[model samples]
Target chain A: MKITCSKSNLVKGVSIVSKAVPSKTTMPILECILIDATTDIIKLTANDMELGIMTEISGDIIDRGMIAIDAKIFSEIVRKLPDNEVTIETLDNLQTVITCEKAKFDIAGKPGDEFAYLPIIEKEDSIEISQFTLKEVIRQTIFSISDSESNKLMTGELFDISDNILKVVSLDGHRISIRKVPLKKSVADRKLVVPGKTLIEISKILSGEAENVVSISYTKNHIVFEFDNTIVVSRLIEGEYFRIDQMLSSDYETKVRINKKELLSCIDRATLLVKEGDKKPIIINIGDELMELKIKSQIGSMNEEIMITKEGKDLLIGFNPKFLIDALRVIDDEEVTIYLMNAKAPCFIKDDAESYVYLILPVNFNSAA
Target chain B: MKITCSKSNLVKGVSIVSKAVPSKTTMPILECILIDATTDIIKLTANDMELGIMTEISGDIIDRGMIAIDAKIFSEIVRKLPDNEVTIETLDNLQTVITCEKAKFDIAGKPGDEFAYLPIIEKEDSIEISQFTLKEVIRQTIFSISDSESNKLMTGELFDISDNILKVVSLDGHRISIRKVPLKKSVADRKLVVPGKTLIEISKILSGEAENVVSISYTKNHIVFEFDNTIVVSRLIEGEYFRIDQMLSSDYETKVRINKKELLSCIDRATLLVKEGDKKPIIINIGDELMELKIKSQIGSMNEEIMITKEGKDLLIGFNPKFLIDALRVIDDEEVTIYLMNAKAPCFIKDDAESYVYLILPVNFNSAA
Candidate 1:
C-alpha cells in the first residue's frame, strides 16, 4: 500500500487497530496489521479471531494497493516519527518503505489476502447509545465477571435490552453487579453475552464523550460496535448467563445510610489484620447511629466504628473486604444505603433511582469473635 | 513499650526501617521491627541480616521498654491511622495495642532480644559528603552494575576514597561507568564494595538536598550511612571489585560532539526495529558534520542521520542501544562528546570536566551493512 499521512493521524489509526493484534499467534499474519489503500480513504485492520478492529486513516492515497505489516514495529515507528508528513510505499516483493523527514524504515510485509476477514453485521436491527453511558455501565459491572477459564459463561457479561432501557449484569459465584441505562429511543428486546475481555478493550477505545454515540449491531454469533472512525467486531459466548434476577431481593431487616468514604476506609483499615492466603472476613455490626467493623486473624485483630443513619432492626454480617471495596470504589455518591436481611443472606447496595444494584453473599464465620 | 506520637511521625519512622524487613525469612524475628523505647527518643530498627536500618521517631516516651512487631502490619496500621496522636502500648504477654482516634488494634509481638542488632561503626573513620552529590553519583553508575548472582562482587559498586576525593565505579561484563565527587575534607583512605541493592535502598532514603550531609563509615564487614533522622547499616560485599581503571584508555580514532537529546532520540527510534531476543546492534557511521545510525534486523532496517561536529577520522561502529540510552538518560548535560577508537574497541562518552565517564564496548557484526 502507498499512502501519505500526518504523523499524528497515522499513529492514532495504528494504535486503535493494534489492540486487536494477537501478541503470540501460530499464524504469522495474525500478528500483522492489514493496510488497505485500495479505496479513497486508507484503512487499517487487525483480527485475533475472537476480536477484530478496523480504523480509517485520514490521508492522501497515492496508489491503490494493500499489504500487511507487523503491528508492533510499525506502530512504534509511527509514534516516534518527527511531527511531519509520513510517506509509506510498498514494492512488488511486498517490502514496505516508511519515510518521515530524515528517518526511513524498510520492513518486510505479507500480502493482505491471507488476513482473516472481519465478521459482517447486518445493520437493520442496530441500536444507538451514548458512548459515555455505555462505558460507565461496562466499568460498573465488568469487575465482577469471573476470570476463571473453566466457566466460560461467567467470563462474559449479560447485555439485556428492552424498550428504551439497557441492563448489564455480571456475576462470579461470590457476587453480582447490575447497571441500567436508558437509551435515546425504544428498540426491540434482545440479549447478548459479550466476553469481558472484549468489553474491556472496547471501553479503552471509546472516547467516553456524551456527544459520541455508539451504534451496536449483533447477529447470532457476532456483535459489532461502531463509534468514531473505528469498528470493532467480537464473537459472542454461546451460553446462558446466570439467572441473577432470582438471587436479588427487595426485602431487608436492616438498612443503613452511611458515608461511602467513611465505610470504605473503616473496612480497609480492618483488612490490615488479614494476611495473604488468609480466608478471614471483615465483620460489620449495624446498630442505631453506629456501625462497627471488625477483623480477627492469627496475627492480630482490628476494629473501627463509623457513625451512620440506621432504620429497621439491627444486624450483624461478615463479607470479603475486597468485594465491598470494589463496589464502593466505582460508586459516585456521597452517601449510600446498604440493605441487610440476616447474617446468612445476601446483602444489597442499591440506589433510590434503581440505576445500579450490587449484591454480595456474606461469609459464614465459625465464631463472631 | 509505650509512646505517643503523631500519625505522620510514626509512619515515617516505620517506613524507613521497614525497608530492611525480610519479606520471607525462616526466622520470624527477622520480619519484625524492633521498637526500642528505652531511650529518651523512640527508635525503630529492622534487620534482614544483610541490611539493617534504624530511625528515631519524634514522640513522647511514657515508659522505657522494648518489643518487636510485624513490620508489614505495623506500617499498614500506622499509615491508615487518623492524623492524630497515636498511642502504642505493649502488654505483659507481648501483645501490642495501638490506638488512634476511634480505631484500635491488638497485635502479637515478639521479644526484642531475639531481633538482630545493628552493626556499630566507629565515628573516627567516618567521612561526610553532601547527600545531593552522593545520590547523583550513585544514579549515574548503578545502572552498569552486573545483576548476575554468580559474580557477587560485580553486583556491587566500588567506593574509593583518597585525599578529599571519592571515586565510584561500576562494571558489568560489557561496560564500565565511573563517577567522581569531592569530599568536604580529607579523611582516611578506604575502599569498600556496597551491594547494588543496598545502594538502591539508600538512594531512595537520601534527601537529595545540598544542605543535607551524609556521614559514612565502614568496618571490616559493615558500612553505615547516617543522614537526617535515619541510619542504614549494610554488610559490605567480600572480594575485590573489577579493576576498571585499566580498561579505560585516553585514546580515540574518531570523536563526535552532539546534543545529548538528539542522539538519545535517534537511538531510541532505531531500537524500534529491534525485537526481543534479536541480537542485532545499532550501527553508527561517523563522518564530517553528519552521523548516521542504522539497525538491520530480520524483520526490518532503519536509519537516521543526526547533525554533529566531528574531529579526527571518520569511522563506523556498532553498540547496544540500551547501554547508550542508560548513560545518556542520567547525564545532566545539554551536549556531550563521544570518543570512538574502532569498530572492535570500546567507546567513551564523557564531558569536558571529566567528572563522569561511561565506556561501552562495541558489538562486532558479521557484516557492516
Candidate 2:
C-alpha cells in the first residue's frame, strides 16, 4: 500500500479516529488504526469493541492496499512532522515507511485482516439535530450520569424523542438532569439509551455552529452518529430506562426567582468548606426577600446571602452544593426560578419555557435537631 | 487582629508565601501562614523549616495582633471572594472571621507564637543583578542538576562569582552545563551551592523585565533573595563543588556549524522512538557537508539529515537525545558551533563570546561493531 497525503489532512483524520483507540486491551491489533486505501479516498478506522470511529481523508492512492499501524506511535510521529506532504508506503513484509521532507520512519505494521471491524447498523430510522444543541444538551445532562456500572441503565442516558421534541435525561440515584430540545426535521419516534462515555466523546467532536447538524440513526443494538466526514458507532445498552417523568415534580408550596450568576457564585464559595468525599450540605434559609446559604464543614464554615423574589410560604432546605453548581453553570439565563415542596422533598429548578429541568434531592440537616 | 485590604493585594501576598508551605509535615503549624498585623504594614509569612517566604501587604491594621491560619483553606477562600475590600478579624477564641460583600467565613486559627520563624542571616554583603539575567542563567543550566539525593553536591548548582564574572555549573553523571554572566557590580568574592528547588521557585517569581533587579545575599548557612516587597530565605547546601575546569578541553579534531532550530527539531523527532526506561542513543554520522541522525528502538527506527558546515575529518558518535535537546532548547542562538575530539571523546558546544558552554559525553554505539 502506498499513499501520499498532506500533513494537515492526515493529522485531522488521525485525531478524530484516535479517540476510539482502546487504551488497554488483550489483543494488540485493537490498539491500531487501520488505513484502507483500496479506493481513491483514504479511510482510517479504529474500533474498541464498544465504540468505533471512522473518517475519510483526501489523499492520492498510488497503489490500493490496507495496513494497521500502531495508533500511539503514528499519532506522535504525525504531530511532530513538518507541515508538508507525507508519503506512506507498505512493503510485503508489513514494514511500513512514512516519509515527510527529510525525516523517514520505518515501523512494522500488522495485517489489516486480523483487526476487528465495526458492527454494521441498519440506518432505517434517523433524526436530525443541530450540533450546538446536541453539545449543549450533553454538557447539561452528562454530569449527572452515574459512574457505576452495576445498574447499567444509570450509566447511560435516555434519548427519547416523541412528537418532534427530544428530551435527554441522566440520573445518578441522588439527582436527575433533564434537557429538552426541538428537532429540526420530523422523523420516526425512537428511544435509546446511549453510554455516557460515547456521548462525551461525541460532544468533543462537535462544533458550536448552530447551522451544522448531526444525523443520528438508531437500531436495535447499535446507534450511529454521522457528521462532517466521520461516523461513530456505539453499542446501545439493552435495558429498561428509568421512568424520569414520575420522578419530576412541579407542585410547590414556595417558589423563588433568583439571579443565576449570584446564586452560582454563592454556592460555589460555600463549596470551599466541603472537602472531597465529604457529605456536607448547604442549608438555605428563605425569608421575606433574602435567602441565606450556610455550610459548616470540618475545615471551616461559610455563610452568604442573596436577594430573591419569594412567593407563597418561606421554607428552609438543604442540598448538595455540587449538584446545584452543576445545574446552575449550564443554565444560560439571567434569572432562574426554584420550586420547593418541603424540607424533605426534592427541589426543582426549571426554566419558564420548559426547555430545561433540574431536580436535586434534599440532604438532612442536623442544625435544627 | 483586624485588617481591611483589597482582594488583589491579599491574593498576591498569599500566593507568594504559600509556595513555602509544607505539603506534608509532622508539625501542622508548618502548613499555616502567620499573619502579623502589629504595625501599619501587614506581613504574611510561611516557613517550612527548609525554606521561608515573607511579604508585606498594604492594609489598614485597626489593632495590633497576630494569628496563624491554615494555608490551604485561606488561599481558596481568598481566591473565590468578591472583588471588593475584605475585612479580617480575630475573635477572642481564635476563631477568625473574614467578610467580603455579603459572604463571611469563620475559620479556626492557631497562635502565631507557636509557628517557626525564618533563620536570620547576616546581610552585610550583597550583589545586584537583573532578575531576567538570573532567571536566564538558571534556565540554561538547571536541567543538568541531578534529581537523586545520594550525591548531595550534584543536586545543587555551583554559583561561583569572582572578577566581575559569574559562572554557574551543574552536572549529573552523564553531562555538564556551564553558563557565564557579567555582574554589574562586584562585591566580596563568594562561592555557594544553592539548592535546585530554591532556584526553581525563585525563577517562577522573577519577572521577565530585565530592568527589574534583584539583590542576592549569601551567608555561611543561608541564602536570601529580596525583591519588590518579598523576601525568600533558603538553607544552602554545604559541600565542595566539582572541579569542572579540569574536565574542559579546547583541542578538537572535528568541528561543525549547524542551524540551531534544525538540529533541535531533528533530534526531537528522533526521540519519538525512545520510550520511558529505554536506553536508546541517537547515532550521529558526521560527513563533509551533512549530518545524519539515526536511532532504532523496540518500536521502530528513525533517520533524519540536516545540512551543516563541517571541518576536519569525519567522525561517528552516539549520545542520549534528551541531553542534546535540553541544551539546544535553552540556547537563544540562530546557529551553534560544535567541537569534537574523537569518536569516543566528549563534544563541546560553545558560543562565540564564551558566555555558554555545553559538554556532552558520548555513548558507545554498537551499530559500528
Candidate 3:
C-alpha cells in the first residue's frame, strides 16, 4: 500500500485508535494497529478484544493494500515528523517505509489477515444525542463507577433511554450519581450497561461541540458510537444493574441551599487534618442560617463555618470528604440544594429541574468505637 | 508556643522545614517540626538523621513557649488558611490551637526537647558564592548522579574548591558531568562529597538571583548552607570520589562543530524507533561535511543526515541517545564542539572557556551479536 497524507491528519488518526490498543497480551498481534488503504480513504483500527476503535484519514492513495504495525512506534514517528506531508509505502515482505522530508523509517509489519474485525451491528434502533450533552453526562457520572473488579456490574454505567429522555447512572456501594438529559426526537425505550472504561475513552474522543451530534446503535451484547470521523464498538456487561431508583428519595427532614464554592473550600480545609489510610469522616452540622464542617483525627482537628439558607429541621451527618468534593467539583451551578432525611439516612443533592441527582451514604460515627 | 504571623509567612516557613521531615522512620519525633516562640522571631526546625533545615519567621510573640507538631498536618493547615493573621498557641498538655479568620485547628504536639538540634558549624572555614551560579552548576550536573544505592559515594557530587573556583562533578557508571564556576574571593581549599539529595533540596531553596549570595561552612562531618532566612545542614558522604580527572583527555582523532539544537532534535527522533529494554545505540558517522545518525533494531532501522563542520579525521561511533540528549539539553551554547578519539573511546564535549565538560562512554554494539 502507498499513500501520502498530512502529518497532522495521520497523528490525530493514530492517537484516536491507540486508545484501544492492548497494553500487554500474550497475543502479539493484538498490540498492532491495522492499516487498511484499499479505498479512497485510509482506515485505522485497533482492538483489545473487549473494545475496538476505528478512525479514518483523508490521503492520496497510490495503491490498494493493507498492513498492521506497532501502534506505539507509529504514533511516535508520525507525531515527531517535521514535514507537512508523509509518504507511507508497504512492501511485499511485510515491511513499511515511512518517509518525511530527508528522514526515512522502515518498521516491521504483520499481515492484516490474522487481525480480528470489529463486530457489525444493524442500525435498526439507533439514537441521536448532542455531543456536548453526552460528554457532560459522562463527566458527571463516570467518577462514581466502582474501580473494583470484584463486582463487574458496578464497573459499568447504566444507560436508560425512554420518551426522548436519556438517563445515565453510575453507582458504587457508597454513592450514586445520575444525569438526565433530553433528546431532540423521541425513540424506542432501551436499557444497557456499558463498561466504564469504554465510556471514559469515548468521552475523550468527543469534541463537545453543541452543534455536533452523535449516533449510537446497540445490540444485546455490543454497542457502537459513531461521531466525527471515528467509530467505537464495545462489549456490554451481561448483568442487571443495581436498582438505584428505590434508594433515591425526594422526601427530606432537612433542606439547605449553600454556595457551592464556599462549601467546597470549607470541606477541603477540614480534610487537611485527615491522614492517609485514616478512615476518619468530616462531620457537617446544619442549623438555622449556618452550617459547620468539622474533622477530628488522632493528630489534629479542624472546624469551619459558612452561612447558608436553611428551611427544615436541624441535622448532623458524617461523610467521607472526598465523596462530597468529587460531586461538588463537577457541579456548575452557583448554589446547590442538599436534602437530608436524618443523620442515619443517605443525603441527596439535586437540581430544581431534576436534571442531576447525587446520593451519598453517610459514614456512621458510632462504628468508630 | 504563642505567636501571631501572616498566613503567607507561616506557610513558607512550614513548607521549607517539611522537606527535611522523615517520611518513614522508626523515630516518630523526626517527623515533627519544632516551633520555638521564646524570642522576638519564631523559629521552625525539622531534622532527619542525615539532613536538617531551619527557618526563622518574624511574628508577634504572645507568650514564651515551645512545642513540636506533625510537619505534614501543620504544613497543610497553614497552606489552606485564609488570607489573614494566624494565631498559634501551645497548651500545657502539649496540645496546640491554630486560629485564622473563622477557622480553628487543634493539633497534637510533643515536647520541643525531644526534637533533634542542628549541629553548629564554625564560620572560620566558610566560602561565599553567588546563589545564581551555585544553582546553575547544580542543575547542570545533578542528573548524572548515580541513583543506585550499591555505590554510596557515586550517589553524591564532589565539591572541590581551590583558587577561588568551585567545581562540581557527578557521574554514574556510563558518563561524567562537571561544571566549574569562579567565586568572588578566595578561601581555604576544601573538598567534600555532598549527597545528591541534599543538593537537590538546597537548590530548590536558593533564590537564583544574581544579587543574592549564599554563605557555606563545613566541619569535619557536616556541611551547612545559609541563605536568606533559611539554614540547611547535611552530613557529607564519607568516601573518596572517583578519579575522573584522569579519564578526561584533550587527545582526539576527530573533532566536529555542530548546532546543538539540530543534533538534539535528530537524536530525539531516532529514539522513537527504540523500544523499552532494548539496548540499541544510535550510530553517528562523521564525514567531510555531513553527519549521518542511524539506529537499527529488531523492528526496523532509521537514518538521518545533517551538515556539520569537521576539523579532524572522519570517524564513526555509537552512543546512547539519552546520554547525549541530557548533556545537550543543559548547555546554553548554540554551537558545541565534540572531540572523539575512535569508535571504542569515550567522546568529550567542552565549551570554549572549558567551564563545563561532558564525557560519555560509547556502548559496545558488537556485544549485540
The number of the candidate with the highest lDDT is 2
Model 1, stretches more than 4 Å misplaced? A367-369, B239-242, B367-369
Query: After superposing candidate 3, which stretches have Cα over 4 Å from the reference?
Result: A275-277, A367-369, B275-277
Off by over 4 Å in 2: A367-369, B367-369
- For every candidate, C-alpha RMSD to the true structure in Å: 2.2, 1.3, 2.3
Local accuracy of candidate 3 as per-residue lDDT tens digits, A185-223: 878998899999999999988999988999988988998
Worst-scoring 10-residue span by lDDT in model 3 chain B: B360-369
lDDT (CA) for every model shown? Answer: 0.89, 0.91, 0.90
Give me candidate 3's TM-score against the actual structure. 0.94
Candidate 1: the clashing residue pairs are none
lDDT of 1 by residue, B1-369 (tens): 788999999988888898898778999999999999887988999999899999998889998899999898889999998889999999999999999988999999999888889877765477888899889899999999999999999999999887777889999988888888888777888889999989998888888998999989888888999999999999999997777778988888899999998899888888887777776888898999999989998778988898999999999888888999999999989999999988899999998778889999999876746
Model 2 residue A353 distance off true place after TM-score fit, in angstroms: 1.6
Q: Cα miss at A140, model 3 (Å)? A: 0.8
TM-scores for every predicted model:
0.95, 0.98, 0.94
Point to the candidate with the largest DockQ: 2
